[model samples]
Target: MLNPQWLRSFAALIEQGSFTRCAEYLDLTQAAVSQHVQKLEERLGPLLIRRPRQLELTPAGHALLEYCEEVSAADQRLNKRLSEHDDKHGEISLICPGSIGLALYPMLLNLQQTNPGLIVRQRFAPDKEVLEGVLENRFELGLATLKPDDPRLLVSRFTEEPLELIAPVSERVEGWEDLKRIGFIDHPDGRAMSSRLLSRYFPEAPGIGSLPCHGFTNQIGLILEPVARGLGFTVLPRSARLAFQRPESIQVIEGPRLVEDTLWLIHRAEWPLSTRAKLVVKTLKAQIEGLSLRNHACRRA
Candidate 1:
């Protein structure tokens, strides 16, 4: 019989594509991941992985990945059911992009005050990780801007936010001509998001309208500090823009806007929401929707 643990380790190896990387995910030594794969292959009596190559799966390995995904999903459903009936809402984990976490996490914290007993674990990750985590049941809920795939992962878009242009108050101008005068404050990933959004909004615009984009920071909040000091301007989603406390010094320009990005609430479609999970999502929607209105008010005020 193939060891289930070894199968799981092999799954990790497939995901990481190398023993060294799998070691980090499983918190196991590189030798251990290799040994687990070796044990798995021995039990099967043939080569599972095409070695001397970078973790290419043989036909057997391909068959095994499908089996593991099904088993892993079932195992998670069983665990969730057991936890639900135990009167332990226990820990409900939700993973989302860092931008959503900034705008919506307070609502999660506020939920604790209402129940006083439910445990909420909010994990911040990028968009792709968040979606995959939801699909794999690594998290009960996830928020992301995704391409929208899979019936198992039900996604409900909550809002679409436009990107706002910002420049230093000192260099603030009312038009696009002024936007071109100073260098643009480009957040590495933020620029990519903006580029995609712009392409989406204006497919026939003039030659992609070049801007001097620079600066690499993973944190969107950090981008504002330099913008406030007149460094340069960048386009960021409205949700991320609200996180910055300083609004007066930084000018939000109307010349160019980013394509709206979708914020979807996701959960497993096959499983009913846990009582606590239902409550959390309810609270989240109300909070986020309410904030959307308030944000509009603030912008218009």
Candidate 2:
């Protein structure tokens, strides 16, 4: 079995670039840190390092650093798991976009109410950050619109959230011409969503940047505020539209059906998710299905 203590010392030394500093951080003597590295090297082969005055890593050391960090993180997670003595109660860490998290909050609350022993810890971030959190094992799962490009991640199609063109309640939108005239308020995902929307509805329209962009904001929940005040129109996912502060102040424009963003649940492929994590995933899947069914019924009615 691999020694987590030795791996921790190796990683700390690489980060600090000195046995003395690493020892100080770990509350161990400098000699202890040196011995830890020597023991690790004996077992894992030479993690080559060149030292004159300052420390420098060889190619082998550079490669080993990534694995060591991963192992150290895994050890930390394992320790936390062991501390939770009750198998019936555990924590699930999740990361998702702000808008999606808002949309799912009610269902999450209901799940928690039903199973009081299960704890769900959630953080809202941009899609990129959410994916990074999952890859780093900081979160057990991530809900994101972007597909995972890394082979190390396992992604499952969560839901296809339809995108809608929205404008202030006072404005009347007929089609693409009105959009061109009114201009747009850009969000973080605005450019990409605009590209896909124009491609689907206005095939011959100019490039996304050619359109008048009033301003840009990275906050999804706040992106529609300007649009609602009649500053401009914007395309946002259904979840974001619902989460907007003034949903009644804005209305979805009637136009050709546009593209939708697919939210996928992403996680590290090799990590075995805890039972609470699995339960949260199942609950989310059911909630999405129910939401879709409700929307479909509303459309029919």
Candidate 3:
């Protein structure tokens, strides 16, 4: 490998137009600058034409100068990218369950709007897919209902999302019998969430599968549509229920037992999060906390 100092001296000699001037610019002795040129020629050969009162470049010298220019350009680009990476700017990729995505997507968009430099990329996925995305390096952050036990992950409790039993405003639900009469509007997590909440509230009630299926939808935004139209009842996370467009059309069934699902925030433990991703995580946590407080206040009222 050629020495970088020698290349620097050679380039500087050409730019300064003389050995004496190159030595002055580089804070080196004239003998040192000349020696650099000598070493370079010994390694590559015939780099310059020593003309009195003028300096001229050989073909080899021209090639080396071009290589030096390319290296300089690449260095500049690397520095620019590093600067952007350290700032609160650039893309932040995250994957989360559909329920949280419904609530968090709008908040993420609002954050991007305020910051202008941030580009948010969010995906709606199940817990399995969320974990996979983070582990595979497709996402910088992930939110899951279950805490991952993988040692490769760094997990923390982000927030708790309550599971709400919802039915049309016109429907009256007083007991398990009422739910059975209405039938079940099932979604991807309908059975799981219903099982958890119903088992706690009505210990005598059968499993969620016992209820006749009224309708089904996998879309988080549309999960409450059938319930809102008085078709049936369903259980969902509070975030999903709140994101429904026609909130007045449906009601959350109040019960003695309250069930909440713990949401976990996850990222790879091997690599630290970028500045933009850390900012996004911090902003999301703050917003969700504020929203949770507001909901608590409303429930108390």
Candidate 4:
């Protein structure tokens, strides 16, 4: 078994991604940090730290972090329970991706309006990194769009965001092949999502050269501005269209079957959820379920 003290140092190192920074922040010598990690490896019977160019966590290191987070959460709950003599009010930390943050954050703030005792800490991350932060005890909850089939993650289906291929109606495009002519626009993460989306449609893994596109932009919001200005067509979540503030800026291609991103509310299954966390989860479920495609624009905003 790894010592809790050692686990603390390990998590700190992993978060900082290096021993020197971890040692400096934790007020421990670099040698001492390295020793703690070596001793931990001795207990684990294998190298958990990959100390090549940068501080990379070996697969074992990742597994240990997950275990440490569970223990840490349990310890926190115990501390809270023992101090139950105090007031019931406490803070709830949350991490979410772009779409949900813009949409649900306001409603969540309103939940605490009548009861000012509740505290909330919100953090924004992309879809994939949000889950990693949650599993590592960085946040109590994460709102994400993609969910892997991991039993250790408890996921609640909160919202279904419709995906659409939006284009300037003046572009004189009608169907999928028109995209071939205009060259599909790329968002910041579109290279990755586009590969995933294409693989789902063509499982044979067609060569990228066979169906090539032009120009990649790292910003999703920027991609839309160009598209509205007659640059090129792009695929985006329907909720994002609310930014136009006018009907003619874009047109949504309907019924041709674009990718659908189902948003899930994710939290570690092993962590003991607090009362505030549970209440927020329930309220989010109720609110998202009550919202239909029409109300999606409202929720995203």
What TM-score fits each model?
0.65, 0.70, 0.73, 0.59
Tell me the tens digit of each residue's lDDT in model 2 across 1-301. Answer: 7677887898999888788899999999999998988897787777855567577766667777888877878877797777454434767678998778888877777877887876778898988899889888888889988887888899889888888878888888876677778888988778888788767877777767777888778887788888878889888878788777777889887556646789998988986667667777888888888887897788679
Candidate 3 ranges beyond 4 A from true positions: 1-85
lDDT of 3 by residue, 1-301 (tens): 7788988899899999999999999999999999999999998889999899788999999998898778778977687457645545677789999998988999889888988877789999989999999999888899999898999999999999999999999999999889989989999888889999999988887788888999999988998999989999999999998889899999999988789999999999997878777788889899999999999999999
lDDT of each: 0.73, 0.81, 0.90, 0.70
Tell me the deviation in Å of residue 169 in model 4: 3.4
* Candidate 1, residue 83: how far the Cα is off, in Å: 3.6
Which prediction has more favorable TM-score, 2 or 4?
A: 2
Q: Deviation in angstroms for 252 in model 1?
A: 1.4
The count of residue-pair clashes in candidate 3 stands at: 0
Highest-scoring model, TM-score: 3
Error of 1 at 285 (Å): 1.0
Model 3 gets an lDDT of 0.90
Query: Against the true structure, whose lDDT is highest?
Result: 3
Which 10 successive residues of model 4 have the least lDDT summed? 201-210
Clashing pairs in 4: 103-300, 188-218
| lDDT for each residue of candidate 4 in 181-298, tens digit (9 for 90 to 100) | 6666776555555565555544564523344466666553466776777667766666565445555887876543456678888888985677778787788667756655446556
- Pitting candidate 1 against candidate 3, the one with the higher lDDT is 3
